[model samples]
Target: MINPVHLRTLVEVVRLGSFAAAATRLGYTASAVSQQMSALERDTGVALFQRSARSVLPTEAAVVMTRHAAKVLTDIDTLMAAAARTHESTSQELRLGIFPSLATYVLPRILQNPAWRKLGIELRVSVAEPGQTIQGLRTGGELDVALVYQVGQSGLAWPHTVNRQWIGDDDFRVVLPAAWGIGPESKVAADHLSDMPWIMHHPGTSDATVIERLFASCNLHPRVVAYSDDFHASLEMAAAGLGAALVPELALLHRPPGVVVLDVPEIRLARNVFALLPKEQLTAQVQLFVELLADTLHKLGTTRRD
Candidate 1:
């Protein structure tokens, strides 16, 4: 392959019409410039210069090659500039997906994080559930990063091409209507809910599936009063004295007015929140955002406990 450096030297030598002048302009010795031109000629199998003892002259071949080299160099410069711009664009832009509940409770804190502004990442978000977010990662190239959660080993379908980093766990707490007289900090047993009216996620969702299994494992069958996929909506139903619903710790960040959070040890359904990205597209900004998210989750957990 012809070296671009030698092509450049040859072009300069042809343009300047003297090896010595080209060497002076290029900050190389005349001998070095002549060696480069010789190497280039050898590589091309064409004599690029007509040489005499007193002065060197560019041959027709040399002149033609110089014109082509000038254009080639310009093209290379343009390609490099375009590549740099693309890299800059990637660094500045972030396409993020978050579960609906996280968007409500955690997204504000993420936006408020100083690191978010310091990184200058422009975010575009998709508010979706965990399953939908995972599907988006597989089908759509639009998302650079997705914040998704899995309820235990809920058998959620995730693309193999995605890489996951565990951000944190969202512990599920049973929320009952205030009128039901369940103390906010009281530990409720799984068997205690056998006959209670329950507000749950749509039956087929990862969350609902896990909750259903939890009930089955405890040999308790509760009557489903209402079904809602939205945590906020489920919380509203729970608050209205309709039934109890399993809610994540993050969702409880803005605890509804009429609901009391109960501790259910036997029903241990903690959803693991992860930062999922297409393996090939994980950039520094995305990694930093994941780190910031984990930190934000920790701070939020602490604040809630206090």
Candidate 2:
């Protein structure tokens, strides 16, 4: 009998076209992933990949197996989900991992919705960053679903066994201290703020790297005055006239009195938010919960604009 675990790894290898890529997504070492592929070939008595010094090329057999493996995996997931639901109680408890911004701005509003009460889901919420929330969705981890965001090439990856759903995009805006005399209607260019002090994310963060590259592309090399990872804190600091900060629209919903948000044509970036759920854990209730999140996120954006 072929191991389902190996099949999952095989699917990843074929989809990503390299053992190393699959390794990163599945949280395995490249060597371990290679070994799993070897084991899978042995179980099936067929050559799965053509291995070269720099690359691993999937064989015809590998592609065929992957196609079949997808269906097999889906069936296995369905079986597991059905088995688990057989013993489920009236009010199902869902372990949800979410980032701070969404939890703060979107969650409370969703909870108040009458539709949420009808879902009969008791949410066990874990508020954390995307990295932590993703970890919680892995096998043997605590969360059944995680809400995460990816900014540019942030290198965020999840296991192939996890299903991903696109929620919405949170666009970043250039915010200046009201004291700086930059108002919402000011047509600003990147060079205009090049010499100004700026509040930024700490160096070495994925978002910071993307934002830095964006600023560099726009020829805006801001002098660093402060570093803040928290969007709310960044807003507060900007309002305090510390420096200009780039904040997402979601965070701007609760903007303080002294910060002016501008739509800088030069700085265009948005974090793509998604919900990750393990295949076997996906259920009607969970899908409904994700829908509620997407709806709330849309409403939040609309409310901010209005």
**Top model number, lDDT:** 2
Off by over 4 Å in 1: 1-91
Worst-scoring 10-residue span by lDDT in model 1: 55-64
**lDDT score for candidate 1 against the true structure:** 0.72
Give the per-residue Cα lDDT of candidate 2 at 263: 84
Error of 1 at 81 (Å): 21
* For model 2, the run of ten residues with the poorest summed lDDT: 55-64
TM-score of structure candidate 2:
0.70
Q: Score residue 173 of candidate 2 by CA lDDT.
A: 89
Which runs of model 2 end up more than 4 angstroms from their true locations?
Answer: 1-88
Give the alpha carbon lDDT tens digit for every residue of 118-185 in model 1. Answer: 44478889998777777777775778788888887887777788898998888887888999887867
lDDT of 2 by residue, 1-306 (tens): 454445666667767877777766664446556666776678667776666554344321222344444555566555445544543445578998999889988999888876566455888999999998888877577898899999997989898889999999999989999998877898889989997999999999999999999999999999999999988999999999999999999898889999898988989999999999888777655766786678678767777862
